[model samples]
Target: MAVVSAEPVKAMKEGQILVTGAAGFIGFHVAQHLLSSGREVVGLDSVNNYYDPSLKQARIDVLKQQPKFSFVKADLANRETTKSLFAKHRFPAVIHLAAQAGVRYSLENPHAYADANIEGFLNVLEGCRHHGCGHLLFASSSSVYGANTRLPFSVQDNVDHPISLYAASKKANELMAHAYSHLYRIPCTGLRFFTVYGPWGRPDMAIFIFAKAILEGKPIRLFNHGNMRRDFTYVDDVVEAIARLIDRPPQGNPAWSGDNPDPASSAAPWKIYNIGNNRPEELEHVVALLEKEFGRPAIKEMLPMQPGDVLATYADIEDLARDVGFRPATTIEDGIARFSKWFREYQN
Candidate 1:
């Protein structure tokens, strides 16, 4: 494992930093961490009614408490607003996490994915390029693995046949980021995050839905006949990996050659890594663990897998550990317990 130079992958310090989707779970947590570190951050969001505006507002309310934190209510898909944001504030480092998430939702309403993920991402890239941001750290997803069928998904893996539109959109992001990195020489790193669960997780995620159904004694649908596996990563761990990566922006790979190019690294200043718990857990075992923590057995309703689904998703985090010397260590039991505790506190 090579440590990304301790030279402290420095970015623009004087210019203000912009964080898109700061009201979302991962974005909110990252923004709070940055604010706590004394960074002057401008958080942006549309406050859409995608999930629950109140939950997003609750996150915004907490961020507003920080003197250094400023909030802006706007949509990322709005090109005018995105352009104006860059013009108004010079951002050195742009962290783009705003997107139309959810794999299944893409099948139901793909227009949302195009509007928010593709069109919205282009607006953000335009802003970064025009503003001359030093480095851009954007959130990618483990779903990009698609039909790769490889255990411990690696960034170096060839991700060509994406099964879902949402996956295709994310894969497109990596290509889009690389093109900019080569053309503009902007240091960019894309994080392929595994299943992130914890306090403030999205209501659409399996953890939240499963926990709710189990608590209410409702039949929880076990997708893939309860044979699914996921590298369930904790949110705090995900945020920590981003924090470590913030200081380790990729530089041009001088050794890169067209003869045998690596998919993960490029001649341009771009790189990607998989952030996961490094251990895949069975779906039913996770349910059992939650049942133990909540003291309620789930009503088993075994069902066939849903569309745009995969049998398993495991992350190969060797590159992350080698670079950052850190990996997600929270076990499913502990992680689920944390979520269960938050559920009890919030739902009660």
Candidate 2:
């Protein structure tokens, strides 16, 4: 594995950064951080109803309060619209976080995944290519590890077998990025995020669903009969990693060899890193923590594992640490407690 040199990061130009999916969970937080750090941000999102539009609007509402932030209501699948936005702004840096999310949902709505993840990503790459964007940082997923039985998923591992369309799409994104990097010399970084959770998280995610169900006195469904594990990374930690990477795009590796090519790096200006907690927590333990935070026991309803689901996911974040000197440190207990507090206040 090649070690990413700890080079001094370049400073981003104020008011020239573009953040897609600014209305979504991680996007919202990342945009907020950029704004707070004195960078002007143009946030774009379709605000689709994949989950609840109300939640998305609420996030946008908060961002609108920041004078340095501007919001654009547009879908990335619309190539003309995306192109126009890029041409109009001529942004130097773009954070591409917009996508049709959810693993199980991908199984049911396969075309949505293709439209948003594939077509949308193409538009982003084209925009960066034509507009001379300095750096393009996009979100990948831990689910890209797919059927690999590896204990800790590393970016260097081959990920050719994706059980779910969502995972396949994310893997495709990384490949597409590499192609662009090789051909156009666009510095691109792909971040494979683990199970991210926190305040303003998607309602379809396990943590939000469990918290809502427990609070409403409804039974919480335990998939795989409570035999699942995940590297539940906190939203803030994910945001910090992204913020640091914004200014530190990868330089092409001169020693990259085709004989034993590393999946995480290339001769082109491209790189891949896993942003995760590096601590896999069992589902049962997560429930206990949530119960403790909620001050009520959950009505557990055990069930078989759903299709398009994995038994466990753990991330090897050594590369991220070596490059950025940061790791996700928030424990599940503290993360859930903070989320629970937000949920209670938001409900009232």
Candidate 3:
């Protein structure tokens, strides 16, 4: 629900936790953080061709170093495989993050979104529902705010129109989760993450693209006439928020009413929150920060707005702050510096 409430929670001391997309940017960070804190983690990833398999492998390499970490290589879309994986490890908590992620890509290949986001998520939800999963935290995206002219997007917003299939698929995930929560009384939490950037971030995102272009002395595309804003939440802050959330499973909202119901709340044990920096940054300003961090100017190439791209994204993380006692406080200067360092290192 959108209602603000909380309680302190200790980390899971025993029982295996399933982390889908463990080879991904945020998923890798989340898995490592859990293993480092003495939690046993079982990672599942399909190792698809959406990006370089090498990068995914590198993340797996890091995770495999932890003694408490185990992994299975398989696609989540296959119901049999997903069921087998769940049966093998009766995880008390499941963090579902694996999916075909990318907006522009979705235009060319809509089937991937349907297969991965929709079908895969349905499989994950079923696994949780049947396995007695205590908590299910899944990744949604700020892109779900497609076509909405809202500033500082809140979880309470009505998101009906999604410009891209990717956004639509993610939106479908939220709806599917809510239905599962209502029908099965499963505890589900959806986090609509803003522009998350840091070390090991996805190569498809603007931060990675801009940084690579600027460093290579190539022209970086400036869409929407360089008039764009995004709330770039750092990876560390996002991981911290997720860590805090895993232990606090949602309870049915007592104040929920059917007469004039809110989309963000339910009488069932379901919840959603915006995980973001709570601040917006202009496109020009972001480029400038990269230029400063890299000590080189980006060769600018102005262009019209992309088909599925939004003009801006601003997250109102009030519920996140109130519930987790945590907020995305990473400054651009520091965040960019960290990213720049990682980029340079990864290249070498």
Candidate 4:
């Protein structure tokens, strides 16, 4: 399915949209889509060296070419600065995507998760509350489903046993957003993105790492002996879901009951959805696809499952499809081909 440009949002027609973490992979793509749709976008990012700042800068450069796009190099953890930006722009909608990503890295530097994911998210919620931002959409993660043995993780599932601080922080974001939504009546939507991949993807992610290792003739380490499964979603599909959701802010669910509450929805204007491919692929299959894309066999190193790593992730995107009338349709073959092409060009 083609990812079409979003329709003009009623509340956003008069003001610019704020895309936090705009320099980040998914955020960059989301901002670009919004900009291409003729929506004015103010992209905010700390541009920190969590990864290579050069890659973030490259994305910013592309956004800079668009006349309607503006960039703000600021950290969300800076409360005063975040407040100033919100007061200045009064964005109709805020897409909060900035966070300290990576489950494994959280073990090494736990404070980064607390500072960026918790404190930074608090700043965003406060901004939306004070500025009367029409809606607040933030990125949650599939990692939040930690320890749940369900075949496909759903928004309705209880996410109480997060194995990593990163997952816990994301869960905290959802809770905090719910509290703020209840108190301030700010329409809040949390998207639990599955294993998202494609062009301009994160270097630390599995696909990128495997591709790089294969190209350099390095051994690609496979956790759980390549037995894991993932619902690897394409970036364009994720972006399209976000774009379609911009205008459909949740109203307080009238059907919500305190007796047996739906974890995915609240009596307040808050909701959650899992945006994923809904098709789980084996880790071995992913590596094989990368090998084929590069036309080189990968030197594989079998390894035990790392702490905080789940064996599989399959998303139940019923809410996303029913609400947005769309679901991710990209096949792994096509998505990997596009990503490999981009990687080859990017390396050159």
Model 2 segments more than 4 A misplaced: 1-11
Report the alpha-carbon TM-score of model 2 versus the true structure: 0.98
**Local distance difference test, per candidate?**
0.87, 0.92, 0.89, 0.92
Tens digits of per-residue lDDT, candidate 1, 139-220, equal: 8899898998967788778999899999999999999999998998878888898989999889889899899998888998
What is the TM-score (0 to 1) of candidate 4?
A: 0.97
Best by TM-score: 2
* 42: Cα error in model 4, Å: 0.5
Off by over 4 Å in 1: 1-5, 10-13
Residue 279 lDDT (model 4): 98
lDDT of 2 by residue, 137-230 (tens): 9999999999998889988899999999999999999999999999999989999999999999999999999988888999999999999999
> How would you encode candidate 4's per-residue C-alpha lDDT over 1-348 as one tens digit per residue?
112123535775668999999999999999999999899999999998989999999999999999999999999999999999999999999999999999999999999988999999999999999988988899999999999998889888899999999999999999999999899999899999999999999999999999999999999999998889999999999999998899878877888888988999988989899999999999899899999989999999999999999999999988888778899989999999999999999988
Report RMSD for candidate 2.
Answer: 1.2
| TM-score of each predicted structure versus truth | 0.97, 0.98, 0.97, 0.97
* Quality of model 2 by C-alpha lDDT: 0.92
- Residue 212 miss distance in model 4 (angstroms): 0.4
**Candidate 2 worst ten-residue window by lDDT:** 3-12
